[model samples]
Target: LHISSSWVRDSRFWKLVDQPAPKLESFSFVMERECDVEDNLTVLPRIFQDDMPKLRNLALVNVSSWPHNRFANLTRFSLEHQPPHIRPTFPEFLAFLAASPKLQELVL
Candidate 1:
């Protein structure tokens, strides 16, 4: 299980990388705060699209700007570490969580 934050910061690269991570079981993204952030999904399409097969847990600790829209098969998650100034939309976050097919628990 591995959790990671921070997208590569390049939508082109994200799109390229997003298609071949099915082996990744556990994933997370404190989706690092970079100097700039445009479209979180357009850049990194979440961190659990194909990451399954071995994934059962997750830990996404990103800021509110990030569009949390995917995390499947996560039996456990630690989606916290929110900064005081961050205010992510629960609906988007929930939508992302809904992407998970095996998510059973979460810890924020």
Candidate 2:
């Protein structure tokens, strides 16, 4: 699944997906905030819990919060344009990296 929205008002897109995506392999979301609006600082809801076992590639742009879940099978991961306050700490980032030993490409 790939989604790019240029006029997002809030960050609740993930919450609308109540069911798990069992066959999802790649997911990408990009939200371009309007200049006149306040930054979207909402943390995204945890996605699909532990049900996305086949997920491999993930990317997010202009997003404030990272989901508090482990993705052990990710081979490509990217995050961009995150606010400083919501960025993961070094230890937390390291742990995130540690969890995905099969990761081949990473972008921060």
Error of 2 at 100 (Å): 1.0
Per-prediction TM-score, please?
A: 0.49, 0.81
- Kindly list the per-residue Cα lDDT of model 2 for residues 1-108, writing each as its tens digit: 887876544446645444587898998877766323336644455777667889999998877766776799999999987766678899999999999999999988
Question: Candidate 2 at residue 15, lDDT?
Answer: 54
> How many residue pairs collide in each prediction?
19, 0
- lDDT per residue as tens, model 1, 1-108: 342445556565456445646677655555555424443422234543554556665665554444334444567767564553454568856675667656677565
Against the reference, the lDDT scores of all candidates come to 0.53, 0.76
Which candidate ranks first by TM-score, i.e. highest? Answer: 2
In candidate 2, where is summed lDDT lowest over 10 consecutive residues? 34-43
State each model's C-alpha RMSD to the native.
Answer: 5.2, 2.9
Judge candidate 2 against the unseen true structure and give its global Cα lDDT, from 0 to 1: 0.76
Candidate 2 displacement at residue 94 in angstroms: 0.8
